[model samples]
Target: MQILTPFKTITVSLFVLFFLTACSNEEATEQTNNTPVAIESGDECHLCGMVIAEFPGPKGELFEGRKSHVRKFCSTRDLMSWYLQPENRPNTKEIYVHDMSRSDWNSPSDEHMINAREAWFVAGSSMKGAMGPTLASFAQKDAAEKFVTKHGGTVLEFKAITMEILNTGSAMNMGSMHH
Candidate 1:
């Protein structure tokens, strides 16, 4: 007589498949919920500029190096038009930003977060015009320090985009359409 183990084999395979699918789904959900979108440098902002945090796309970044300061932008048009200007530009090449993805408090960094070989910069604004709180970034600590020394600007980090910074002198001016 032969043993009937065909049913047992099929049951084992089904259980394995179900278990794998469940595990992968849980992992994906957890990752999505736990991280912010990645930010890039070159892409234009939804507002202003043609470089850095002002370049267009889903996300852009700005930095004023002296600290590890990094500012992530949301839209190209929103960022560039009001963000980038020679007067608004920080005077240092130490600032490094990306233009590949978007980021925020919810999605700060990612697995492939350090994409900087080809980076660009754009200016920034708190509101319509008339300037806002300017931040600086640096690649090396010493370089950033030198910049702060020469430019008289402040040093900052990537994790310091607080309401106080964004609200300085009403950076959010929703009144430019009448012009």
Candidate 2:
């Protein structure tokens, strides 16, 4: 009975240790998944091959899988274009967009990137991005409205954005060639 008691104690200790380890591992993984990735210079747009740092408007990034595979874009339009394709949308874990309200139009920077899902986008704006029409994003609706007043655009929530809207805006920008 004494030997059996020690064996049972050891078994219970092992189980508790295993459980704790698993929980810690899960917490670590969750943190990793939620953390934002930094964009670096020379990172080419996944769709356009343009160096992302050279752009002056909204930029985008998509992260996928446990490996956190990233696809960076020089423009939000290109990101949306890439996302609308059926093949690229399935594995996407998170999407990020540059918050134009936080960026300097004269010198755009990736430090302004925010969660694309939570952002408010202004389409049909006068601003031109790395590609054509810029999809300016803001963390607040008031900021988007201010952008609309200044640049002439329609404010849209993330979920409300559609491929047709993006296409139309891009076509309009192309027609005007603001850049």
Candidate 3:
């Protein structure tokens, strides 16, 4: 075995340190990406600026960027409004919604959230949420159907919710509110 020079030893040590640090950073990033964020009491809706906690219904959140930055919404409708806008549609990693089946509308929390991509939403319900007519998200298809049975709405998946549908519901709700 050859004796190592000081420079070689230092270089080897530095290489090992760099390798370890890179592995650690990758693990940290994975964990952050997989974890869902919570909605705090003072969190405001990105679209309407309403205090999210004040709403007694399902809420929405979008996670974007490498850092997993969150944008909270007072209602599912507002979240859709923001998502449908062309300028706001890039780099979105995940979309979340409060599952009405699991949520305490009186006191909303992160535990109630589910991935909007896989969720079923009840729209055009008689119930008025934070901003106006809002879609209620559910984790299961049966739960969404059950909600519609009691609340009177159409069950729709995330992709099926078109801008026209949203606009029509919003216009109807807004018109009725003033009457």
Candidate 4:
């Protein structure tokens, strides 16, 4: 029979502790990796092929459950344009957009990203996105209303936004407006 010395027991315990910590860190990394990824310097919009970083507005990222790649968009408008299509709706695991209330209009940061479906949108704002006209996304309805007061647009829920609104660049025409 073999008995572990004090030094051997301590070393073995430390090795087990280290191994457990490493496994925990790995799981944390995997979970965070599933979340929104930062746009690189040359990342192109999945819908437009335009450089995402060059655009000045809230950006978007879509994750498909069956696919490993994340679809990046230069503007929230373009993201909705693609997402609103029937073919693209299925298998979507997650959708992220910059919270305009928390981010700069000229250079939106990934740190302020929020779920697109839960956000309030301000369409036809004086602010411009990657495209000439874009939807300004906000996490709160009051913020969206304040934006409308300042930028001249309409506050709309995610579902209230329609293809017609995107096409016409006018949320006022939608009839169901918060402002």
Per-residue lDDT of 85-158 in model 1, one digit per residue for the tens? 45535522222332223333123333323322232222232212112333322334454455455545343444
Give TM per candidate. Answer: 0.36, 0.78, 0.80, 0.75
As for model 2, its CA RMSD to the true structure in angstroms is 4.6
What are the per-model C-alpha RMSD values against the true structure? Answer: 13.3, 4.6, 4.5, 8.3
Please identify which of the two predictions, 3 or 4, would achieve the higher TM-score against the true structure: 3
How does model 4 fare in lDDT? Answer: 0.87
TM-score of 2: 0.78
Q: Higher-lDDT candidate among 2 and 3?
A: 3
- Candidate 3 versus the native: TM-score? 0.80
Q: What lDDT score is found at residue 120 in candidate 2?
A: 95
Model 4 segments more than 4 A misplaced: 1-33, 170-179
lDDT of 4 by residue, 58-137 (tens): 89999875433699999998999998898888857688999988998889989999988899999888887887678999
Instruction: Name the top lDDT candidate.
Output: 4
- Estimate candidate 3's alpha-carbon lDDT, on a 0 to 1 scale: 0.85
**Highest-scoring model, TM-score:** 3
Candidate 3 weakest ten by summed lDDT: 27-36
Which of candidates 1 and 2 is the stronger one according to TM-score? 2
Show how many residue pairs clash in every candidate, following the order shown.
50, 0, 0, 0
Alpha carbon deviation, residue 62, candidate 2 (Å): 1.2
On lDDT, the stronger of 1 and 3 is 3
Model 2 stretches astray by more than 4 angstroms:
1-32, 177-179
Clashes of 1: 50
